[model samples]
Target: MTANVLTIAGTDPSGGAGIQADIKAMSALGAYACSVVTAVVAQNTCGVRSFQALSPDFVADQIDAVLDDVRIDAVKIGMISNAGIAEAVADRLRHHGAGNIVLDPVMVAKSGHALLDPEAVSAVREALVPLARVITPNLPEAAVLLGREDDWTVQAMQAALPDLLALGSDYVLLKGGHLEGEHSTDLLTGPKGTRALKAPRIATTNDHGTGCTLSSAIAALLPHHDMPEAVARAKAYLHAALAESDALDVGQGHGPVHHFHALWGSGV
Candidate 1:
């Protein structure tokens, strides 16, 4: 039987990010993808134009409709949008005793549009992040969570992992793509220890949905592998996607990483 993976996030009409990207990544990794949309986002590869959020009650209804029947093995969360949606998602996940939750704190879009509301950041940090087995935060998202906009060195990311773990997640994966370097590094920290994973930075502008892709890939692989292995494989999958990111020409702005890189003959 195929494992079920759920995404509680907004929708991207452009199919480059949010629920669209999450489902593509999950399905590519052999998981049944399910979704509860928090917002209907009007965006293309260029950038997000605007978004309309669903009612908190409706978001809960969508979550309930799925969790009540499906045996979701893992969940990848993104684009909480507001405090109400944040609290509602947390409530439902906790109610179901959901396992292998991968939280990607998607605060900003690749085009520099704000996906997370400024005020709701606190609600998500306090209410939702704790339930996640692992949290994947890019450098900017980590800075927003930590309230520090300082330059994030590889060492800074390593030190920040434990600090982020204090937010109640069992593990934290701080992605180091935004930092200038030869390799795109990620630090995974947990009770066991901290390990640094790196991949040569593929030069491409088509990285719009990298975070969503990575987190969903992790959730898709979690049922078959241990936590550290899942994260490592997900990072590799993302790196391959980035390597072939130029395959898709969707919009004028930052394009999307090819989620079907393997199927499309990436040979990675």
Candidate 2:
């Protein structure tokens, strides 16, 4: 059976991140993709210029409309810019009994623009984090959620496990992409225990929408694979995308990963 994956996120006109990237990743992985937009963002591969969020009630309505009709096998959530939207998403997901939910704590953009409101951080931490099957947060995002300084090493990430687990999610995938090293590692911890999923740091400047791609890939794979396997596979897919990102020249500042690297063949 084809798995149906829904993405609740904002827009990226550049098609490298947010709803665009989510749909691409899900479809690339052979899952049926659905979307509910939370915001309309004006951004290119370079950076975010501006964004206007939708009303919380309308966001909830969109969720309801989709869940009422479609059998969503899994969901990937990103870029909830405010507290009201966060609460609305959480409430609607709970109301629908949504499963295999993958939450990517999207706080900042690649150009260092703040995508999430300061106040919404707490709302997502409290309302959304607890409901996710797996929450994928980068170092800075994890630090903000925990109200602490960003971690710099694998040991620090390991040390923060107790608190990260306290967020109440079934699994926490703490990404170490910001850490300076030859290998980028992510720590996944849950009832089964903690383990590191590492991948070679691809030498590429076109890494736009990496978080969205990874989380959506996992959500797409969740229906058929276990948490660990899904995450591992997602990491591999992102790595390949990044490795092949230089094939296209989308923008001047930063380019997008080749989401169809395998399907489209080389020289894309």
Candidate 3:
């Protein structure tokens, strides 16, 4: 059976992140992609200049339209710009009993511009985190979510994982790329316990949409019903993407990972 995945996120004109990246990642991984745009961003590899948020009602309508027609196997949520949109999405998903919702708490861009409003962080915690099957937060994002300093080490990340789990997600995949490590390690914690995914960090500037891609990849694999397996596969997929990105040049600044790397046989 074909698995249909929905991504509720912002639109990135650069196509490196947000709904565009989610769609590409899901489709590349052999799943059909559907999207509900929560915001429209004027962004590029350089950074985000500005963004326009969609109305909450319209966002809800998009969700309803997709869910009414398709057998959505999983959902991946990205940059929700405000509390209202977050609340609307949470309400709709809860009402529909949406399963396998992967929430990627996108706070700042790769260039350090804040994508999510500072005040909206609380809304995401109250409204969306509880409904998510898994929450994927990078080191900086995890620090923001935990209300701690950004200089968290691997031990600190491990210590904070439980608090993230306490926020009501079935699982939390704490991405450790921002930590100063030779190998990027992502810690996945859930009802089954903790599993660590370790991979050699590919030295490349083309890592713009990594968080979006990884979470969407997880969403694509969720129909198989093994969260740990899905996370492992997604990490492998991400590694391949980074490795394949060596040849392609999408932008002058930090470019996007080659998501179609597997199709071209360039990925490991």
Each model's RMSD to truth, in Å? 1.6, 0.8, 1.5
Query: Per TM-score, what order, best first?
Result: 2, 3, 1
- Cα lDDT for residue 241, model 3? 90
**Which residues of candidate 3, in runs, are more than 4 Å off?**
none
Tens digits of per-residue lDDT for model 2, 1-268 = 9999999999999999999999999999999999999999999988999999999999999999999999999999999999999999999999999999999999999899999999999999999999999999999998999999864688999888779889889999999999998999899999999989989898888999999999999999999999999999999999999999988889987888889999987785
Model 3, span 1-268: residue lDDT tens: 8899999999889888888899999989999999999999998887888999999999999999988888899999999988889999998898888999999999888888888888999999989999888999998888888898889887888899899999999999999998777898899999988988899989999998999999999999999759998999998998999888876768788898988887876524
By summed lDDT, which 10 consecutive residues of candidate 1 come out lowest? Answer: 259-268
TM-scores vs. true structure, each candidate: 0.97, 0.99, 0.97
Model 3 global lDDT (CA atoms, 0 to 1): 0.91
**Tens-digit lDDT track of model 1 for 165-211:** 99999999998888998888899998899898989988888888889
lDDT of 2 at 171: 95
Q: How much lDDT does each candidate structure score?
A: 0.90, 0.94, 0.91
Better of 1 and 2 by TM-score: 2
Q: Which regions of candidate 2 deviate over 4 angstroms?
A: none
